[model samples]
Target: MIVISDLRIAILGLGYVGLPLGLALSRHFRVFGYDSNPIRLRELRQNVDSTSETSSYTLEHSKITFLEDIKDAQDCNVFIVTVPTPIDSNNIPDLSALCAACRDIGSVLSSGDIVVFESTVYPGVTENICGPELESSSGLQCGSGFFLGYSPERINPGDRSHTVETVCKVVAGQTKGVTELLERIYGTALSAGVHVAPNIRTAEAAKVIENAQRDVNIAFINEVAMIFKNMDIDTGDVLAAARTKWNFLDFEPGLVGGHCIGVDPYYLAFGAQQAGHEPDVILAGRRINDAVASFVVDQIANMLRPSSRILVLGLTFKENVSDLRNSKVAELVTLLTQKGFQVSIHDPRAARLQAKAFYGIDLAEDLDESYSFDAVIGAVGHKEYRALDSSKLLRMVKNDGVIADLKGIWRAYDFPPPIRYWRL
Candidate 1:
């Protein structure tokens, strides 16, 4: 067994999850942070965290050595994989990034090394899929020549409270010894302690369902929002009235985007179908949530004139974060564009180049109140947009134009007679 003092930790895929975890672990162990993106490596070297999860001050003072090439981490005994587990166009769980990380780590894998995966995936992927890939590449037998562990990542981008050190970590291993090692590793990093699952697959299942449950809850609220829209009743008002009860679950209605909630349910759904369960409620929730962008666009389009010039505030999936992965705002913009609305997007947090490259939509350089649009849509609830005074918001919209609030961030502000306020 490797002691905490002797552990040489290598964190693969230093994005939102791996970077902060690496910084925390570096306090106890000699850490090597490896990422595939050269640009990311350069940015981190200069103490720039594009994800906004880590501060430049923390990055500059961290002891972990950021590496562009995997070979630099050859000496590490504990390799933690935190790569993305995205879905295909068909919504199938795509493990290409996870498998590639395995192969990369396998190339330099040594006897008695432990590879722990933090990427969210369905059950059996660690033992069935990733383990074999490591063995085929390194010619090492699982549980003997090397070991595997699971510690699902809980990093929430743009969230300041629940962090890597604050959240309770869940860990499992192929063997009791490996599990104990993970306990010591993560336990030292997280002040909130850890929950040791019985096995690796159990840990995997626990992680996948975390996001799936949130997806379903939000889907229900989104459906209710649509239902209330027909009756001309505000969903916010209904929620406020329902909250007087003790047991009301408070999930808001909005576009479910990001790498987690929008994507993880499909992994669970895929696993259920493979086990012969239809997963009716799960798939139905997905369908309702996935169609929310179109629903929002339809409502906004009906209120606007054909070929009306529109300005959309915020393009990232959620507010106050630069991460645009699987953002539904792009879908909203595309839908509006298809309906003959001339739309321009403005998100101070999102990367302009990435937005253009990913969606072919050019983000406005700056918010110019001097050039108002026929309508202004609040698609995301960024703090910057939320802090905008009513006068500034009114200035963004032309006379008799609409103020479409998708997330209800500006539901209280009553516009003048010529201008109208609309919300989902």
Candidate 2:
């Protein structure tokens, strides 16, 4: 029996999803953020987040304690897991990080404590996989001695409008009483209120499908882009014309690569496959998205001759964030290099050292240097890249240079008359 007033919240895995939630929860409850990475803990204490999702001011002002050891989180009654649920080499759901977080929480878990999982996973992950781990490790009976809950995180890395507090939250628990307790806890921070799900599996299914839906939508647009390329029609222009229809979904075509959209579908698909149902649309979407890197490479190669100098606009998975996990830009760079093109990657927010360590590619921070290229590939629609003048960017290329706009960031009418442009 725990009182709401005495709730001490511990958030595990303080990355993009956990950091913001920890900051928000710390305002009302005694919050402790735990991560296995000591470097991350040190960086957070100094008000520096490599992810760039949260500002230094917010981290500095938030009354939250940081811990690198699992033992430090023992006193917390409400544990929230927000670790990354990434995919393996074969595009399978690799639950190693999530399982490690659960195992750590289980070791320190006490009776009457409530564990809430915010990591995006397939249905039955929290109750079926994590709950048993907790019970086995802590020697406690679930629902009787300890309780479990699932509240899928809706944290978009670059999104400003739909933040942690503003977005509607879905919460579920082992039992009805546990559900009410989670609702009260989350309702304190979420201004958009909370939706109490029937069960933990339903909550997990809802979150996984959210990203899967986005993946399918983007895959549809990417396929359209490929079709438009064959027809010599601008995909963006067609989308603009189609937008006049009231019921049309305005989904743009681009490389779908990130921690969530690219990976979450696998988690759902894996579970679906285990249940003996082959997911056609979901697997098809994943296949289309996976092949987009090579498709982009082919389009770029066709636009330029061999041994041409190409500049890749951004390297991070998305714009304005430093997260490069499972980025598709690397594949584009590799394919372009293999085709005898000299590629130079530049991103304002991405960490140069991390990029070099992870991808073996050095990132150039300054684009002001006088270096002209045969083409400028707008791979990512970062705000910094979008704000640049078309004329200035055109000057970086030769008279007959090509501009490959993957995200359609530049207007076709705005490009110089002599320059050739290709957009998806």
What does candidate 2's lDDT look like per residue over 1-424, in tens digits? Answer: 6788889999999988999899988888899999889999999999998887788998888899998788988889999999889888898888898888888988999989999999998998888888888888888888887999999999787788888989999999988888998898889987889999999999999999999999999999989889988999988879999999999998998888888999999999999998899999999999999999999898779888889999999998987778888789988899999999999999987888989987999997688773589999988889998998877888878888988888888874467657888877
List residue ranges in candidate 2 displaced over 4 A. none
TM-score of 1: 0.98
Q: Kindly list the per-residue Cα lDDT of model 1 for residues 1-424, writing each as its tens digit.
A: 7777779999999998999999999988899999888998999999999898888999989999988889888889999999999999999999999999999999989999999999999998999999999999989998999999999998788889988999999999899999999998888878999999999999999999999999999999999999999999989999999988999999999999998999999999999998888998889999999999999888888888899999999989899899888999999999989999898999999998999888897899889742578899999999999998899998888878899888899887877878888887
Score candidate 2 by lDDT: 0.89
Weakest 10 consecutive residues, lDDT, candidate 1?
Answer: 365-374
Candidates in order have lDDT scores of 0.92, 0.89
